[model samples]
Every structure is written in C-alpha cells, then in structure tokens.
Target: MLVSAAMLLTLGGCVTMSGDYNVTAVDANGQPIKMVMTSHGSAIYSSRNAFCSNFPKATVTIRDFHTGEELKSESPYHCR
Candidate 1:
C-alpha cells in the first residue's frame, strides 16, 4: 500500500490536462490584454463587467488549444 501511494504521487505530478477553450483579449498590435483558460467565451462574456470593461475595443479571440486554430474570427469586445 505504501509503495502504491508513493508511485501514484510520483505519477500524478506528471499528469496534466489541456483546456478545450482558450481565450485571450488582445490589443490592436496583437498583444495579449486578458486571458480565460477554463471555458469558451468567458473572456468576451465578462467584458461588460468591471474587470474587462476597461478595454472596450480589445479584440477577443477564442482558440482551440489542441489545434491552435481560432474558434472564431477576432471580434471587438464592446463594453456597451
């Protein structure tokens, strides 16, 4: 039992999971302005809130982390 626990602990540290949806808000120059790794569109969804409302014109791009493809075309996040 002790050996099993130790082996599990050692391997657990090496295991990792990648998110299906990765979103980031970028400025006109394509510089990163914000990030949301947990779910799709969360970054754009929160743009109306206090934290993201500051960048009214930032472009939010959602991408497939496994494929490196844009889930959709970059769109401007309007605070209004």
Candidate 2:
C-alpha cells in the first residue's frame, strides 16, 4: 500500500496540464478583438489565426523553448 501511494504521488507530480489565455486586441477599425487559446504547457500556440477568424497584420512570430517565445499576441489592427 505504501509503494502504491508513493507511485501515485510521483505520477501526479509528473503530470502537467496546459494553460488558458483570454487574449484581446484592437484592429484598425477600433473594435475590441478577443480570442480563446489553449496552450500546450510549452507556452506556444500554433498561430494566432488558428484561434480567431481574423489575425493582425503586424509581424507575428513563434519560438521554441530554446528560443525566446512571446506568450501573448495583440494588436490594434485585430480589434479594430
């Protein structure tokens, strides 16, 4: 029983879940833009367009763990 309990604790600690983000931005039209995104615990999403119907015209970039990756993306062009 003790061994099982230890194994459960270890497994639970190893389990990591993704995070959620409610992102908002502004488009050229001056409107509010919102998107719901799901992160893979790595703090990286495939692309902004994947989450929302419209994507900002501003330069968008995504990086890996080794590289510096921006967690959130927003722009006036998107909300407007």
Q: Pick the candidate with the highest TM-score.
A: 1
**Model 1: residue 77 alpha-carbon error in angstroms:** 6.0
lDDT, residue 44, model 1: 30
lDDT of 1 by residue, 33-74 (tens): 654543544443443243246555556655666787765434
lDDT of 2 by residue, 44-64 (tens): 334445533454443333323
Query: For model 1, what is the alpha-carbon lDDT of residue 15?
Result: 29
Off by over 4 Å in 1: 1-19, 28-30, 34-36, 40-52, 73-80
Candidate 1 Cα deviation (angstroms), residue 52: 4.8
The CA lDDT of each predicted structure is 0.54, 0.42
TM-score of each: 0.43, 0.28
Cand. 1 Cα-lDDT = 0.54
